[model samples]
Target chain A: MNVTTGQSTDAARAIAAGRRSRRWGAWYVTEHRLRMMRTYTGTVVIAGIGSPLLYLYALGVGLATIVDANMGPDAVDGVSYLVFVAPALLATAAITVASEEFTYPIMLGYKWNPTFTGAAASPIRPVQIVDGVVYSVIIRMLVNLVLFYALMVLFGAAPSPVGFLGIVASLLGGLAFGTVIMGYTSTLQEDTGQLAMVQRFIVLPMSLFSGTFFPLAVFPIYLQWIGWISPLWHATELARVFSYGYAEPIWLTLVHVAYLVALIVIGWAWSRRIAVRRLNS
Target chain B: MPAPVIVARDLVKKYQDFAAVDGISFEVASGESFGLLGPNGAGKSTTMRMVGAVSTRTSGELGILGLDPDVHGPEIRSQLGVVPQSDNLDTELRVRENLLVYGRYFGLPRKLVAQRADELLAFAQLEGKEKARVDALSGGMKRRLTIARALINDPRILLLDEPTTGLDPQARHILWDRLFRLKEQGTTLLLTTHYMDEAEQLCDRLVVVDKGTIMAEGSPAELIRAHSTREVLEVRFGSDHNAEVGARLARAQGADGHRVEVLPDRVLIYSDNGEAELVKITEAGLRPVTSLVRRSSLEDVFLRLTGRSLVE
Candidate 1:
């Protein structure tokens, strides 16, 4: 019995809704999101499988032969261009999928459709909603990254035995970028082309300048900052370290991990804070 | 009286300099059908949100089921069902899936939620809509489905914010019938509405609100009895002459007599016997364009308190 606030003893201890305090509330919201994503299962599957297959075939087989013939047998760091570009392509997939999951779909949950409010009306807190969304999108990214890695294996681009670790690297990379956008979207009361503007000005420029198809050193010094700051570049660099054993200082490798992790922590905290404020306001 | 299931004291909600809900207080006993009656922008929805434990009060003390909402928000919300003013149903899921998903949000057992979803679908008259998409349902069906979804967790209190705002007459009647049954079953129901008829039909007691403050509070009968006469006699002397005729009628009734209300189209004479008042008006040599006598209702009570029509 909390006498000061008038909360009853029986009511305080006897948590009622589905039984007690919501230990699994976040997972339940994740299940709902997964079911909603089921409506677009076809698109997810085709994009997951088709994008990797198409990109790998064109770059690894068709273009890699030209580069290998012109610049000698081992073109990049004594390895074929196919091996070097495959890891970047995998990280790029992570960023692309993360951006798509974080933008309009978030808009739909908070404004255009507002199913998140319906969830918030129950015992589920707003922070749980944020965690649930992150979990579901992480699941989607896992499946896609795994498929991309499998194609890299089939194309013989993954030379080292530990190249499968790139999937974990790419997953972190997705969260690093995705959660920041998720936090930003939670504050939108109404959309007046802001999200589309974000997609155009931020997402498109990120993939291009992150050295996806070429080495950052060839892009000159001033423009290299784009690669240095972009999550895609750090993730791609980290993935390249695993696949075909691309050479870099061990400390620089640790910096890539720390950078993506810092982004994830900051972005995730920002999202939870903003979601709770907006929903409880 | 039974213990109150909900209570609010000096509840205020502000958005910067603009106050959406000014200082107001109310209490609802167990199994009671309470309502907040007001026009749009009168703080009814804001009050509902605070009571539902979803929105934070700017300054207030609120207790739902004996727990402070600010402290035990998840606990209080778990026991309450909220039907928002707008339908926020998931368009991506099937109709029954909406119920199941919402029940799961409360962490309810899956098997129990499934069974209740079927029963609630039947109760909402959406028996065959288990697999139907939400977008396919009609307006009335969607409202019913929303109600059904709210009940999936078997909440002790149901909070409906303007439950029948956009429905047609037939749809409103059906929804009212369902609400009446929920009341009969001893569910503590709290609702907000602008329609006097809706208040008359559903609320056991209600507060008349205007401009973010409560103007009056009572049952429909008691409010009408206190603020209005037994009957009202409306005399239309044409819109052009309504003002001068209203002044002449005021003189006929005298300053101490019953009230004469001049609307844009007609003059309403509030008295015990409207027919007798009409007779007196005619004998006084005022030839009205038309006349009618009707019983006073909450509509008249609201007009008396706020000096504005309920629906306008």
Candidate 2:
């Protein structure tokens, strides 16, 4: 009986030591993000950065001369066509970064590689797994937005002192889109061509209708509803308001900020719940 | 008295209308090599998943390392290592990067992770494949790497779900060797396998699970002895002649005069002395085209309990 008691005490001590040494889930997710960056750094630099800069130069500077010759001096905004489209380009870059970084990467984490499963087998809980993934996406979006903003300034796309706010607006736009799309990605079990459909049907239509390429007033009254509900439209409107100081009521400005903020909050909560269900169920 | 390294009481896991793991209870001691032996869809994997704390139980209680998974999932998991049946290696990373990244998930220091990665790669016999991409390695190499990655945290309990299901003979032998070494080092191993040979080789004591419940549990020899005769006599009198031969062999009994089983291709006569049965059959003028006598094994025990082969 004494020997058995001694054995039981030793077992209790070993288990106690085991519980004390568990790893945090955040460390696991950060490692996955770093590995992802290493694998795709070359592609990100060439496609994410290079393509946007080339478009800015080719359309903003190269084609602006042709448009200026056809119209009077103030054909765009009492400034060159290049200057008018520059801030819009900054907003566009932010939306693009959000779309690219959020959807497929979230799918990869949940479905394809299932690194989260590996992490869950450790001391990290499912909620921490969700937090780590969101944290990584936010970091990536900010860095990419900053680099894109710098390029916009260097290329003479940003025309006003308030144009710097376009960077902040772009990040807000990305956060709104990323948080929402991550929620969608978390519920999906299999790939089933949904991601491609999102890129083509959803992202393409939103980019076209959100006034990134043209003024929102040109659209028919009913069609304008597409821009009104869009986070991109809100971001673009905020960027235009800051860069050109568009005359608007204080209530209207508040509405724009409210739209983006609501998206970030609701999307984040929904995604976190979905992640917990899918991973821990 | 050691409080059992793993303990469960009436653990149940249900998926919608179906119960994947019905109410079952068991305990495993520290440093013991235990096995869940069963066929596919026998609920062994589901049981392992519950023990690993990845799948939540529908009812009853389960505790790993003296902690409840519901409240302390992360705390319990940190001390446990799991090798899933399927190889889900990160194909994007190199062999060495896989181990290093897994160590980092446990929040190991960078220098410590590097040192452990080197040691594990060598231990898994993947020393020279460090820089090689996962896709570039063979099935066996990838499995070894996964095992090494699971051990990066120096876990006390290792759970393996069919560790060598789809490997070549050489790879299977290599894996068996490594597992044997780990067992000798006093690591508690819990494994699931449909292969009786694998269970016989590795498990000190095992539970034969069938359709979500344990059919029997004991050491290999004890199980065989308890559920099967000491020896079996197999006689195949051609394919179509089995029925006639079975009738004749049934009349010619063993020393204890037990009945015989008639199979499609052969007849099995269960007895303590198979050679004596064979002599009685020959003296009765029942000439079989082929005949053999062998000791009963765990396969027979499984067949007696479940009425099906272990693999099928």
Candidate 3:
């Protein structure tokens, strides 16, 4: 066996220097998860840069031509079809990023790798673990939103300076969707391909029906309810209002912001509860 | 007397109608190494979790570092180091980062944690492998790193649940050596293991647990002496006829001052003078296939207490 002299006394001094404040513990948990993110930085960067260009090229440039030829240019919302669809695409990006960031990593924290249990053994509270994970994902969403927003700018998608407000709406929309998905994922004990089903059934349908490519007014009254419940739709409408000054009443704008805020609060509370329950159980 | 770092009075952890850890009481004094000896399903891990302040006790008093686990869990946990049954090192992080990140969980300064990480890597004999990914490391390396990570907080008391369960003999001995060093440094240690030799080697005192209850509590030597005779005589008369030999031995146990236990493959005769007992058995016109006499161990004590082997 190999023998190495231990600096037990120095190590003890260092440990004794640790802060007992609860907030630092939460920050440290966030720090650790952020480092975990660095392992897949390549994938993150590619997704951040690639997703927006593909959507803009495929939908804005390619599909916009047919819509323009049929409806005449500026037929929808008094702007070109490309400009009108851009804000919704940004909202969709945020929601897509939210769904991607929240599922597998949360499962890894709870089950596959059980890194959360390792943190649970430390001084950090269980709810802080939830906060830390959500915090990291929000940061990831912000980055993705910024990169996509920049692409939207370079592609001539933004027609007004207030289009930047679309980024805020996208983030709120992501949190509303991401944190709720996070709460649901934390309660899962087994994978069983459910997240794939979520992508297939929930995320896909929400993106398609949330008026990302077309206005909800074009849909029949019954089918428009999908846009009402969907966070993406609320965010898209809010973004359009900001991006190209898409007309809407003041109270209706407040409803969009309130809906996103409510979803965030509910999702935040649920994720905290589920995380604590699972860790202590 | 030094204060007990951990005290549990009638500790009970009930899951609905089933008590995972039934009413059991014990204390671990500062700097004293204690063991919870039990087989699988014995509630040792459950008790350890309660003491570690990770799992809530159903109805019991568990005071860690003289603080109530229910109210001061995070505070108490800040001062304690816990090594769970399985090594849950972050496979995504490098070997050194595992210690640094875990140290930060205690709110340690990153600079200090980084400095201590190097020293701990050396202490755990993982010096050159600091940059290796955790998943890329061998089992022994991973266990050593886990131990090092637990020590990042320099906890006054360390709780280890089956620390060396999956390790090979060499690895187990290496880990035992590290734990012995920790004990020598006056770190209070609490561990759970079903291996009798592990209990004997590391524990200054131990409590035998089975089916969620404490069966006996004492030092390993004292438990062996109290619950079993000084020596155990093993006599195997072929699997087919061992039961017949065991029955004959049981009939003579009263006169011989011994006890006979018939197991699946062999019969164990508990007696002070095992050689003399073996001679008496052979003199009764029974030629055994093989026989040996050895000093009784904690395995014998557990068998005498529960009528079952410690590791089945």
Compare the candidates by TM-score and give the number of the best one. Answer: 1
User: Candidate 1 or 3, higher DockQ?
Assistant: 1
List the pairs of residues colliding in candidate 1.
none
Window of ten residues with lowest summed lDDT in model 2 chain B? B250-259
Span of 10 residues, lowest total lDDT, candidate 3 chain A: A1-10
Clashes of each: 0, 0, 0
From the highest DockQ down, the ranking of the candidates is 1, 2, 3
List native contact recovery per candidate, as a fraction of 1.
0.62, 0.42, 0.48
Residue A160, candidate 2: Cα error in Å is 3.7
Best by DockQ: 1
B1-312 in candidate 1: lDDT tens per residue? 866878788889999999999998888988999999988999999898888878999997787878877777888888888999999999889999999888888877789999999999999999888899999999999999999999987888999999999999999999999999999999999999988889999999999988889899999999999999999999999989999999888877856488988898999999999999988888978899999999998889988998888887
For every candidate structure, what is the RMSD over all alpha carbons to the true structure, in angstroms?
1.8, 3.3, 4.7
**Tens digits of per-residue lDDT for model 3 on A21-44?**
365677788899889999999988
Which pairs clash in model 3? none
Which tens-of-lDDT digit does each residue in B170-225 have in candidate 2? 99999999999999998899999988888989999999998898899898888988
Candidate 2's error at B96, in angstroms? 1.0
Residue-by-residue lDDT tens digits, candidate 3, B1-312: 865777788899998899999998998888999999999999999999888878999987777665666766677678888888998999988999899889989887789899988988999999799899898888888999999999997888889999999899999999999999999999999999999999999999999999899999999999998999999999999989989878888889756667888998999999899999888888888898999999999999999999999898
lDDT of 3: 0.88
Those runs of model 1 whose alpha carbons end farther than 4 Å from true positions after fitting are A1-14, A18-21, B254-256
